[model samples]
Target: MSRFLLSASRLLALLLCAVLLSACVQDLTGPDDPDDPPPPPVRMRTVYDLKVSPRYIDVVGSCDKVFGSPTAGEFQYRVEVNGEGRTNGFESQNYNSRLGVVTGRVAGQQITFAPRTYTWSSMSSPGRIEAVVFGTEWDGAIRDGDMSNRRGARTVPFALGRRPGTVTIGATSECRLVLAYEAEWVQREVPA
Candidate 1:
């Protein structure tokens, strides 16, 4: 009986110690400190639109407001005859450009939002909004205001153009349309 009591007491003591140790360690993933002001809100937005149908579209870009500094990126695009181009011009001029456009947040190196595919909701934190910019990056040109060649920069009044003809366009830009005092930029959290 005494041995049994001793063993039981030892087990109880071990259990108590384990409980106490676990309690001492708190969960680290709760809300941030209220005192710590949230990180600045960074968002990507479209300021203007470029229409390309006549083969020589014009682009004019500028940000009405700038919150912080951002880097400028570049993209490469191509022009085809309604998805009809020879990759090797010698053979058929079948070219595929994949239309590259380097985008970044309005200013920060890191982006707070990304593109989402939802039917009814609006775009969330994504940088470049997709609108039939109507131009190929080849003939497409951003004139006047020259953004820096540095990565992770932002440029206002980005004006780019493309040659006109049956044109369809999509984009993922990095410029943001956020005020300086926002936090945790959000886009369609979920895509449809």
Candidate 2:
């Protein structure tokens, strides 16, 4: 009888220990427990379609005849805003192939673009000319699903050379141009 009592006590002790352990675990990991781990951060992405227009502010040096005045034109762009508010996208216009990759940031109602540089070589009358284009100062604001007050500038500096090592002093020219961009929102998307 004493051995039977001992066995029953051991079983009861083990059952009580299991119950206490389960209760502790429930307190720590239950759905309603304050100590429960938070759910994965909600990720939200936004996409905007816009039509951008460019206008010339200034043209200088020999570029006036080469590039002429800025023509009235519009380009389409698809901009994606990530969860962290970083913007990345591409120009959907076929004529905009010359424009390089587009990257920027959007905060609240304000948008800005990162500076970009492009380099290429072309044949001039004398020889091959290397052109470096620098674009900067792009800023804009978003309002009522449209973008306004957008402005930017670009500089093109060229060096003309007859041979790999031969450069002509008078053949080089630098052009500065300013651009104003107006964007009309075509569409907006937010993933479910």
lDDT of 1 by residue, 33-61 (tens): 88998787666453323221212212222
Which ten residues in a row are the worst by lDDT in model 2?
162-171
lDDT of 2 by residue, 71-164 (tens): 2222222222112222233233331233423223221112234432222212121222222112221222111111211222222112222111
Q: How high is each candidate's TM-score? A: 0.23, 0.17
For model 2, state the Cα shift of residue 63 in Å.
6.1
Winner by lDDT: 2
Query: Where does model 1 exceed 4 Å of error?
Result: 24-31, 43-45, 55-192
lDDT of each: 0.29, 0.30
Model 2 shows how many backbone clashes?
0
Candidate 2 accuracy as lDDT: 0.30
